[model samples]
Target: MVEADTTLAQVLRSNLMLTGTKIGCNEGQCGACSVLIDGKVVRSCAMKMRRIKDGATITTIEGIGTPEDLHPLQVAWIVHGGAQCGFCTPGFIVSAKGLLDSNPSPSREDVRNWFSRHRNACRCTGYKQLVDATLDAAKVLRGEMSIEQLQFMIPEDGRIWGTKYPRPSALAKVTGTCDYGADLGLQLPEDTLQLALVQAEVSHAHIKSIDTAEAGLMPGVYKILAHKDIKGKNRITGLITFPTNKGDGWDRPILCDEKVFQFGDAIEIHPGPPNVYFKQRVAKGEETEPLFAAAG
Candidate 1:
């Protein structure tokens, strides 16, 4: 059952459970609650049920594309870094789609003006990326370029210090569609647990009785591996200081046996959750963030 005064945003999120349609600034100043009504984009939070016609058609973010088979604009959003947070992305995408549907060849100013005329305010990507993304999508729509060619990075003008021989993996990397080893591992069929490294804090440490009684019993922890669990000689080979240094691969161990090597050496990689601290700010004046070693 639908409420009398409930907005389209509410219906998409609360009723239909299309949580991609984000709600922000409920007064409609933010375009976070954007959706299409009869192919036109509008702020869903301000759109009341009473304002709709009898047979009106509506489309939300879910109607746009999926992760596997994304729309060109959706792909462009990732390439152009326009859709950072979901709050403004759905509305901005719908609004952009509406604009491109009507005007296939829009200038940068046209995109900027179109967004301004629609009140498509975004907090993450300022506005330049959005405009650039719209223009790129317009090119794709105008059949000037293919989706695969979007990955080709343009070099400088003539006599460039570069070669044109296409790298096999360049396209995927450029389009942000390449899945690394860890990504492939996460896509495994079975439920896979994550490994979070708890490194040694000090630069050096003396041998002492290690304790994991508390850490092992923490919530969501599956296993806490010690040195004994490692089968082979713990080492990171290929660190050849001299040509004669070719014997044992005992530089860094799979797990610390008696002493901690470095300050941040991963001593124990306990089972834990993954990748939440990756929100380093974007190009358009986003906040700076700390970098850390990647997970496997």
Candidate 2:
């Protein structure tokens, strides 16, 4: 049983613990939480528990296939390199399953139009592989291709390059059995503290004070950590690529303490002291001229 305000995505993920249905942009702008409701694809994040009709057949990514007895779509996804990072794979797979269930012989354009219409955004794999995978899955459903054909063979030299050997985790990813970061919450202790960021609203300003008394009074409010709460230097110290950074690597603050440098800056931290960490001089002249000079 779920509250009226609970979204279908929340019901599937939090209540039922069927985390295969992912939630990205929970406002429904992103189709990451897409699932099938009575064989029709719908963004689960947009669906509310109260709005669901009684006895309506809801199909999440888990219902489509399994690690054992994998679906054609999952196999094709592995072969076509359809998912990288795999956050958006389940949504696409569910959407594609819905399409193939209705129209088994959809063209590439049809697949493209369907994803475009549904706004199934993917940050990885460039999307071409998704269409390719879906098309091949359609062929398998239509009996034009065998599922075994998707398997890659190891060459005599054992060089897997240029071959389509699926990643060890690919099957889990496509089948929605893989555990992502958000899914880790299922295994976390009930008393574990969850963190939320409090960002700076203005681009630049001296932080007079952050009033957390009202928020601290709210129930279940464990602790409110500010810069003052940090015992050590509240900075991200590392010169990743900037060899000529003024503060070496101590410039970037973990939490902005005194002044806000930009909007959305984490509320604690500040820039480092004014001193050139590294300096190099390049002289342009004849063969006798110094090509390089350094000062630190």
The top-ranked prediction according to TM-score is 2
Candidate 2, 1-296: lDDT as tens digits: 55665578877886678898888787788788999999999999888777889999999989999888889999889888887888899999999999999999999999999998888999988899999999999998898988887655677899987788788889888888789888986667755655656788988888777787765654555667778787888777665737777666766677787778789989732222111101111122211112122211
lDDT of each: 0.67, 0.79
Instruction: Please provide the root mean square deviation of candidate 1 (C-alpha atoms, Å).
Output: 12.2
lDDT of 1 at 69: 65
**Cα lDDT over the full model 1:** 0.67
lDDT of 2 at 119: 83
Off by over 4 Å in 1: 152-296
The CA lDDT at 152 in model 2 is: 58
lDDT of 1 at 124: 67
TM-score of each: 0.52, 0.82
